[model samples]
Target: MTKFNKIVPDDFNVPMYVNGEFFILRPLSPVYSNLDYDAVIASKEILGDIFSDNWPEGINSREDNLRYILEDYQDFQDRIGFSYIILDDEESICIGCVYIFPSLYEGSDVAIYYWFNVKFAGTYLTVKIENFIRSWVVEFWGIKKPAYPGRDIPWSEWLTRPRKKFTD
Candidate 1:
């Protein structure tokens, strides 16, 4: 991961938006922070458990979420990472989020994390959504050995390995 800030190749076309039968994936701006904030807070406990991290802890305010969403959007624009807000098929409700970022470990091309609202955790749509994401990363993005640290590799093992952060 030496200076591997760009997860995909320069010629690769990063998908900014994806529309599927079950859900829609798109970058969210600060203007839609309310929807993102609502889903984040409502699914805080579950999301923390899913990621095994303390994330939505201090993000109790919509303003705080707005800043985070702005950063997410900026990351996509910069082409360093990709984060998408998963909305319902109608594109009105924020259901969850999925992220694709350069892996900090040596063996993986990229690290991916996706979580859904607790209510949709085990639902059919969630399963389909996860499949779509995995296929998109592998088939569309051409990511080999995409690391799903929490799922495929346990978080403990992943953290124990040496890190390879992006260079300045």
Candidate 2:
């Protein structure tokens, strides 16, 4: 397994343009629980056939979502790397979240998982959000390159369950 870099507060909020709107990024916290879940579920509904199949479930309840966030925070603290919350300034709400994990196979590689709500599903917004997400990764993770060429998975091809491991 790849050792995770301990995530510490950098004392600054990351910025991104979400469909011409500006959003501030902060470390995922207990307060982000409901917003994260609602946004993701909303995205799943709105995006319809344009969503990730590997998205984890069980976020329909606030209590359950809180537990999930806490676990994720602990995981990040323990070495899962960085996870962040995207907050809307005008509306004062969180509309999305993303998690970055160190690659177990290579120290120089990282993986990102993200979800946004349906309210932000317009094509322009989608492109902006993707740009925002990747930019944050590049800046925070100390990646010298924009993205690992020839190693990124296509969104369409990633819509299936991962291969199962078997042992006797």
* Model 1: CA > 4 A from native: 1-4
- The worst-scoring run of ten residues by lDDT in candidate 2 lies at 159-168
Q: What's model 2's TM-score?
A: 0.65
lDDT score, candidate 1, position 134: 86
> Which digits, one per residue and each the tens of the lDDT, describe model 2 over residues 65-141?
78878877777556545567777776367667666654333323555766566676455765676786777567755
- Judge candidate 1 against the unseen true structure and give its global Cα lDDT, from 0 to 1: 0.82
For candidate 2, the per-residue lDDT at 56 reads 47
Q: Model 2 Cα displacement at 25 (Å)? A: 0.9
Q: Tell me the TM-score of each prediction against the true structure.
A: 0.91, 0.65
* Steric clash pairs (candidate 1): none
Kindly report which residue pairs in candidate 2 clash with one another. 43-118
| TM-score of candidate 1 relative to the true fold | 0.91
